[model samples]
Target: MRRVERALLSVSDKTGLIDFARGLSELGVELISTGGTAKALADAGLPVKNVSDVTGFPEMLEGRVKTLHPMIHGGLLADRSKPEHMSKIAEHGILPIDIVVVNLYPFAATVAKPGVTWEEAIENIDIGGPSMVRSAAKNHAAVAVVVSPSSYDGVLNELLRNDGKLEAETLKRLAGEAFAHTAAYDATIAAYFAKKLGEETESILPAKLTLSFEKAQDLRYGENPHQKAAFYREAQGGQGVASARKLHGKELSFNNIYDLNAAYNLVQEFAGEKDPTAAIIKHTNPCGIAVSTTLADAFTKARAGDPISAFGGILATSRPIDAATAELITGKNTFFEAIIAPGYDEDAFKILTEKKQWGANLILLEAEFGAEAAGENIDIKRVSGGILVQTEDKHAVGRADLTTVTRRGPSDAEIADLLFAWKVVKHVKSNAIVIAKDRQIVGVGAGQMNRVQSVRLAVEQAGDKAKGAALASDAFFPFADGPEAAGIAGVTSIIQPGGSKKDGETTEMADNYNIAMVFTGHRHFRH
Candidate 1:
């Protein structure tokens, strides 16, 4: 244990400062502070010595050069066990500082505000605070560093119990926390600068990538029941599953959250439309999706697309939930793991909670939609040894992006269904196939190892409904087998990226079957 005789305190967040300082003063420890902290302590009737008196140098550069002197750093960094270090401090008349408490300026909060100038942000960057923290943390055996107000009560209890001394283990833990605090602070500043530079140069990738996340929840288990799991939200706040508000139902499981994310993202694709859109997700893949003039119709068509897979699935909509939709969702032979929408009417909420017994187990979430949704987010996937980061796949195939390659061109109605199927296929897993008619997905095959198998699965699921429906592939067909399978299933049109070496063969097969094919020149492969 190391006894704390003298301590330095400088903080931007002065929470619990008075009580903590008073406790330290009662223990006969000398308190030294700078600037506003010193003034605040003195006004509270506590014995406080100004840092200017200890260093014998007045603060200059508008209080920027207050604590950078040798007297301050040497006092904190000197090794008490070393005879040479003690002799140098004694020869220089430097008093040893046993504890250092500091929290840096609010650089993260300052830059987050709108219309913040570079001059203002640069001024908020702390230098002296981080220096003292690192110095004390580096000499953890002889010094105790405190960086958060949350640790104040714990430290005070320990100090009181140990007669104003801190244990070496406690000091080591505090030092580790101090380093993490500085690391996160520096990462935020670096990200801000990188964004500014990228905007000016029109560059997408930064020279170095820095990310920070805060723990959101600890789940009961991971994908499997035996694995550990936790949820983390990005330090930079945005709208999505992470920002959703739980309105009803039991706690969300790990698999439920995963499927919720996939379902919500798929529904957001129709945010700009006035029509109601519904998407059903199973195991992070879209089982059914539809858009209609009414929410009830949307739910009916979406659920009809694949009733077997839609059972116990996650349901998401681009509009509010009303009475008619609530009744359809909670009716007999209909069940869902979760329901997500922008809002829920009073009658609808009551019916969902009181009318159906199974509703108690359904997770209900209210999320932001349309213009309020998050903008231009990054997608991250963890591989075996590292992570792969890329910009989100937000590319939508417009009329201009579609190139007619078949002898027969697509009709207006077929073109609309092609666009709708294209959007749904983008969210499906790699080697995906989607068949849709009138903006409603009739069948979807996802995560297959081969493209032809995926197409066959989708066509088989569609059955008689495959007639006159458009087909969408996440990527180009490697051979003519995929298009031939779709043609045999009675598919009227197909849309895919046209970058494969056998694109000519695929086009010839489409022409032979009198099917319309459009090339998007872009592929979406979600692994």
Candidate 2:
């Protein structure tokens, strides 16, 4: 037999409560509510029977003991189709509830405030709310559970179409969401307690840490066509391009993700600075990065890094996109996948969107991510299940750390460029080599099998531009062969973290070639 329509309404958030109650009333569904909900329904000019009226007990202990009674649970939990459960409910004069609309107290919000006391936080934890939700979810075969305000409209539509009845499949899906909601709540509570009182700062036991992240979006594909991938975002705040607001464009691709991350990390160094800069990224590395008085000039120098790679790359700037810079970018036939900045000029948008094929490929985002200090630890990875985690390589080649091993000293301009190259090399995969001229990348050799080969490859890519350029290595030169390769290719100055046993040999080789060299006393081996 079909059960009579009834609903149990208990909610702390009163958003759309009156309208929801009124809709249920229009369907001739009896509303049984506890405490505040009953008062709210009564104020809305709708009839509501108090929970105490059905349970036959008055609310005690300042409303804490309102809905934790046997009569309410028995009616909500009884199987309506079973004759024995129905007979018992009839004998006890209990009215079955076909729907439950509930939302928990604001425990997370209460504790989020500054200087909140433990007593206040404990008081906000609702016991009866979660219990009622669980009972309704467990017996969803005969009841509809509505926990989210977002689901209120859908539930109302279902009732409007079916005359206050819901399909079995819809009920089951709502129940699943209810369980997930409670599980996440309990996990947050457990993590908070362990962080505040139960756990020590440094314990080296084999601890299992489960991080829960929700899906941000589904990507077009993974790094390769055969692989599958999706993007997940942290629930808490700290993020970069992962949390950026996409003002325009289609879904981001795998290559777009790689380049955008690199560009985003680089531009953060200059975020909000009066001196503007531009960074162009390709294949998870910086092909062009430069700072200038104007963003257009910076982009010009940055694009000179590797024009071939920049053809289909991603661009990020520290300032707003101006008309001149936008014209410079849009005038080219180069196929850029994405562009991000603090904002865009109206004329700039006009030029980009007016193009024939611009709408399909171009993506623009608004983000202002500033450079923050790195964490104490860093993590690196390798193929075949190899992992490395340690303190970050924060050592930079300061002027005091340099030891002039060569007879010829570097010019002041050469020294400045050498420092710039050194900074760029650290972020590249090892064994890394970088060539710089006038504070911009000329050629970068990264992820090579050997140090000498990486140096040779960087110089080869630099070609005729290797003359008068400064070079930086991720680690110390193991032998003089690396310097020899650079010397033959016309590199003038070099910087490296020198702890090598063959340091004297390399110094002699640099002196023989009349090239200036400095030992930075630090290494930045990424892998």
Candidate 3:
């Protein structure tokens, strides 16, 4: 292989460039660098030739026109092996630049800064850097291009492999990656311009997006063994559980991600409230949820919903994890998979982490601002092929949203419980049935194909506990049979979206059972 005769080094991020350049210089490869890079290399007590010396053009327009000269382009773009191309280059006395190292200005970083001006941001865009990189990459068969600081080690190793020469295969790969890097940089610039210009219409051509995410960890398997899976950490400034900083713990699992997302999103619903709250999540549905004056009482009430199901499940709390509530939770012998809380008391941490199982899954996070900030609407799933998206169940129905369709109005206590059940029902799967007494869930039937079947499942789950309870459905009852089934299970009040054509029949059925019914004029069908 022919040795690299000359290299152009100009970079914004000089991570491993100093060492890589030193090795190159030691191998007798001549270096042609711009102002800052030349100074850096000269500062290291190495002989350096500045681009101005080679191009013979004084740096003009504040160094913007340094490397845009014909001499520089002629050397990098020339096909040395071709007689015609070589004749032109030889006539001009332009030296062949066998390698180019350049990284563009940090435009994205500058724009992301707070209170940045358009003029200031526009000024940070680099011109000569991208041009030089593309020129070198376009002639990869004769020259090597390096655009990323992370690839410095690879480039140095490749140069060392063939005694200071880069192989053709390595050159081709580096060129491809160089183009990818430039494309991503350009896309970010375009997106910023589009947003600032307030362009509402998407361009006819698809905007190619490249998201660089580092692998967080490997799971035991994907959704299925046949399917592949890997957890990736999104870039900083992104939101939700993926971005959550795990203060302490082992690696998170596939189930942990899903449950944490559900828990975090549901807790966002209670944001800005003074009351303490706790929610238990299973299979992406809240089995039990409660709010109280104290975090301890909230967990107690929430755990009462279905203590069996709460065992080895995910727990999410809105308030800081106080010692008392942590102690109460630790006292239970059940093995919970994960617990997500805003903050943890030192004592609580010591107590919780003592258990081996809890040590692997305890996640402590700072409480994010207001639950309402989670999102306006939550997306739900029916199957792999279809989805259902609607505004999240953040609705706290006022008297205006509710209209009594039955002869008797629900008692004040029943109304409160009806609203409680309504909130729980919204988080459950479609055709969901929730039974609540006082302010706690007694039973939850979810993901059934039929309303009556859902009612029966919830009633069976509650067993004798279904008596004197209010029932909430995710959607309107298609017929009166669901209400009749609830009445047989001793339900006393019903709250539904109330848009079914059989509304009269359902209301009459409620009246016959002495059960009060109210319509909220909205449905939360979480398929």
User: Residue by residue across 375-438, what tens digits does model 1's lDDT show?
Assistant: 3566889999988878788888798789999999999999999999998999999999999999
> How much is the lDDT of residue 199 in candidate 2?
32
If scored against the real structure, what TM-score would every candidate get?
Answer: 0.90, 0.79, 0.78
- Model 3 has how many clashing residue pairs? 3
Writing each residue's lDDT as its tens digit, candidate 2 over 165-260 gives 888898999999888767666654554444344334542212333233557778878998788888875433244776678878878877677678
RMSD of each: 2.8, 4.8, 4.7
Candidate achieving higher lDDT, 1 or 2: 1
Using alpha carbons, what is the TM-score of model 2? Answer: 0.79
Give the TM-score comparing model 3 with the true structure, all chains together: 0.78
Collision count for each candidate, in order? 0, 0, 3
* lDDT over C-alpha atoms for residue 423 of model 3: 71
How much is the lDDT of residue 58 in candidate 1? Answer: 100
Q: Which stretches of candidate 2 lie over 4 Å from their true place?
A: 1-4, 9-21, 32-97, 102-135, 186-206, 224-229, 272-274, 371-415, 492-527
- Candidate 3 lDDT, 141-160, residue by residue in tens: 99999988888888888888
